[model samples]
Target: MYVTFVGHVIEWRGPAPFYFVRVPEDECAGIQEVASAATYGWGVIPVSARIGEIDFSTSLFPKDGGYLLPIKNAVRKPQNLSAGDEVTVEMTVRL
Candidate 1:
């Protein structure tokens, strides 16, 4: 499944800090409908994601009844992205 959405980059402070984009509610609902088929354990859905010209593979993390798409540092530096910057993400789910 292919989906695209614009979201802001946000920082999550866990054991280590990380950046992510929260999937919009409507889009999250759409993913949830097919999540059982696509998700591994813990509701993680594998997907190939692209932001600007950067492409990478990662899992959508379930949080607060939604999903957070991790934005890798490698993708961020070249793109000059930081927390609070709005980014458009294209994702292809591997079912």
Candidate 2:
């Protein structure tokens, strides 16, 4: 399954700090339907994600009641993205 949306990158200061983009509530709802088949465990949904012209693979983390799309440093560097930046994201769920 494929989905696209714009989200703001935010810094998450967990045990280890990282960047993430929240999947919109509407998209999250749709993802939830297919999440069981796509998620391996711990509500981690495997997906191929693209930001700008860069593409990478990562797992969507379920937080609160929504999913957070991790924006890795490799993807951030080339795209010149940082926390608080609004970015267009395209994701293909690996089911």
Q: Each model's C-alpha lDDT?
A: 0.94, 0.94
Candidate 2 residue lDDT tens string, 31-95: 99999999999999999999999999999999988999999999998888888999999999899
- Which pairs clash inside model 2? none
What is candidate 1's CA lDDT for residue 78? 96
Candidate 1 Cα deviation (angstroms), residue 31? 0.4
Clashes of each: 0, 0
Writing each residue's lDDT as its tens digit, candidate 1 over 1-95 gives: 88999999999899998999999998898899889999989989999999999999999999999999999999998999999999999998889
In candidate 2 the C-alpha lDDT for residue 69 amounts to 98
**RMSD from true fold, candidate 1:** 0.8
- Estimate the TM-score of every prediction: 0.95, 0.95
